[model samples]
Target: MIKNGYRNDCFVASVLLTLYANFGELGGVEKLFRRIGDKDITAWNSMILAGARPGHGSSHSMQLLQELCQTTLLQIESATWVAVLKSCENESDLVAAFVDIEWKDDSSWSSIIGTYKQNDMELEALGLCNCKEMLNEGVNFTSYSLPLCFSACSQLSAICEGKQLHVLAIKSGYNRDVYVGSSIIDMYAKCGNIEESENVFSEQLEPNEVIFNAMICGYAHHGKAQQAIEVFSKLEKNCVAPNHVTFLALMSACSHAGYVEETLHLFTLMLDKYKIKPKSEYYSSLVDAYGRAGRLEEAYQIVQKDGSESAWRTLLGACRNHNNTEIGEKSAMKMIEMNPSDHAPYVLLSNIYNAEGKWEEAIKCREKMAKIHVKKDPGNSWLV
Candidate 1:
C-alpha cells in the first residue's frame, strides 16, 4: 500500500499500523509510523497501541504518548488515554498518565482503579473510589467499579470501608447485581464476619453459581466444612452447576478441618462425577490435607504422581512440621531444582533440620543460601 502511494492517507496508515502491531511486527510498525507524513489522532493512537502491545515493552508506548502530548496539536481523547494507561507497567507510570488525562471519564477512572487492584495496591484503589474530589467531579461509581471497590476492601479487611461501599451499592440499586452481591459476601467473610456474609447471601432473591461459590468459599475460609458441604448440596438441589472453584473451596474446607478422607472423596468427585480436571492448586490442597493429618507418606506419594512446585513446597513445609528429614530433604531438593532462586525451599529445609535437632545441617542450609545470595524475604504484618 505504501508503494502504491497510500502512505499519505492517515486512515490507511492507521489500519496498517494496527495490523502490524497485532502481528508483533514492531520493526515494520516503527518504519511505517515514521513514514506517515501527516498523522491524525487515529494514526497516533495506532502507534501508541503498537507500543503498548503485549510482549513489547510498555516504555515505548509511554514515551510515544509523552511525545504526542508535547508535539502534536491533535486532541487527546479518552481512548488515547486508555490505550496508554494499558501500557503502564508500574504504579508511578500509571499515576503519571492518569494525572495527564485532561478529562477523567468513567473509562479512565475504571482503568486506573482496575490497574491499582491488579497491582495489589488495594488501599490506593479504595481511596480513589471514595475520594471526595472524585465524587465532586461527578464521577459516579458504576456497577463495574463497585465490585472492584468491594474487592479492595476484602483484601485490606477494612470492614468499615466495606460497609460504607455496601451502603453505596444499595443506594445505587446495584446491590441486586450478582457480581456486586458476590463481592459483598466475600468482603464480609474475609473481614471475619461470616454471619454478615451469610446475611448478604440469604438476601439475594435469585442467587447464581457465582453467589453460591462465594458463600461456599467464605465457609471454607472459616473452617466451616459442614456448612460448605451443605451449601454444595443445596447448589446441587437448586440445579446450579458447580464450577472448578466450587470443588476447590470444598477441598480447602476439608483440608483446613483435617478431613483427609473427605478431601480425597471430593477430588475423586471432581474428576469422575463433575469431569473437571484438577489443577495444581487442587493437588496442593490435597497434599495439605494429608500433611495436616500427619500422613507424610501418603502426601509424598501424591506429590510423586503429579506435583507442581507449589505442591512440593507444601509437602516440604509439612515435612518440617512432622520432623521427617528424609522426605523434607527430598521435597526441598525438588523445590530448589524447580526454582533455584527461590528462598522458600531453603528456608523450609533449614527449619526442618532445626526441628530435628540437626544444628549443623541447619547451619549448612543458611551457608548455602548466603553463598547463593538468596536472601529470605522479610514478613510484614497486615494492617487492619
Candidate 2:
C-alpha cells in the first residue's frame, strides 16, 4: 500500500497504526505514523493509544498529544483528551494537561475529573470543579461533568460538597438525567446518608439499569442484603434488565450479611441466567462469601479454579481470619508467585502465622519481605 502511494492517506495510515499498536509493533507504528502527511485526529488518537500501551512509555504519548495540541488547525476531540489522560502518570500530569487546554469543553472537564476519580485523587477531582480559575473562566457544569463531580464527592465522603453539587445538578436541570441521578444516589449513600439515597432513588420514576445498580450498591455497602434483594425484585418487576454491576452488588450484600447460600445462588443466576461471565472481582466476592461462612476449603477451591492474584489474596485474608495456616501459606505463595513486589500477601501470611502462634514463621515472612525490599505502604486516613 505504501509503494502504491497510499502511505499518506489518512484512513489507511490510521488503520495501519492501530494494527501496529495491537501487534505491539511500536517501532513500526512510530515510523509509519510520522510519515503520514495529512494527519487527522484519528491518526493522532491512534499514535496516542499506541504510545500509551504498557511498555511503550506514556511520556511519548503525552509528547505526541502536546504536539497535536500545538497544531492549531487540528481540533482535539474528547477522545484525544481521554487518550492523553491515559498517559498521565500522576495528579500533576493530569492538572498540567487540563490547564494547557485553551478552550475547555464539557467533555474536557469530565475527562480530567473522571481521571482524577479513577486514580483515587478525589480531593483533586473536586478541586477542578471548584477551582477559581475554572470558575473565572465561566465553566458551566453539564450533566457529564456533574456526574463525575458527584462521584468525587462520594469517594471523599464530602457530604457538603455532594449536596452543593446536587443543587447544581438540579439548577442545571440535570437532576432528572439517569447518570446524574445514579451518581447522586451513590454520593448520598457513600456519605452515610442512605435515607437520602433512597429518597433520590424513589424520586426517579423511570429508574433505568444504572440507577437501580447504584441503589443496590448502596444497600450492598450498608450491608442491607434484604433491601438489595427487594430492589432487585422491583427491578425485575419493572422489567429493567440488570447488568454485571447489579449482580456484583447483590453478591457483595449477601457476602457481607453472611448469607452464603444467597450469594452462591446469585452467582449461578448471573452466570447461567444472565450469562454474565465472572471476572476477578466476582470470583473474589465468592471466595469472600465462602470464607466468611467458615468454608475455608470451599474458598480455597474457588481460588484454585480462578488462580487470579485477587482471588488468592481474598482467600488469604479469609485464611487469616479463620487461622488456617496451611491454606493461608498456599494462598500467599500463589499470590507472591503472581506479583512478587506486592507486600499484601507477605503481610497477610505473617498475620496468619502469628494468629496460629507460629512466631518463627511470622518472623521469617517479615525477613523475606525485607530481603526482597517489598515495602508496605503506610496507612492513612481519608478523614484528614
* Collision count of model 1: 0
The ten-residue window of minimal lDDT in model 1 covers 99-108
Residue 255, candidate 2: C-alpha displacement in angstroms: 1.1
State every prediction's TM-score relative to the real structure. 0.75, 0.69
Show where candidate 2 strays beyond 4 Å.
Answer: 1-76, 79-140, 340-343, 363-384
The TM-score obtained by model 1 is 0.75
lDDT of 1: 0.87
Best candidate, TM-score-wise? 1
Off by over 4 Å in 1: 2-12, 15-44, 47-79, 82-109, 119-121, 131-140, 363-384
Residue pairs in collision within model 2: none
lDDT of 1 by residue, 94-205 (tens): 6776566556656657766876787678987888777465677777777788889899999999999999888888887888999999999999999999999999999899
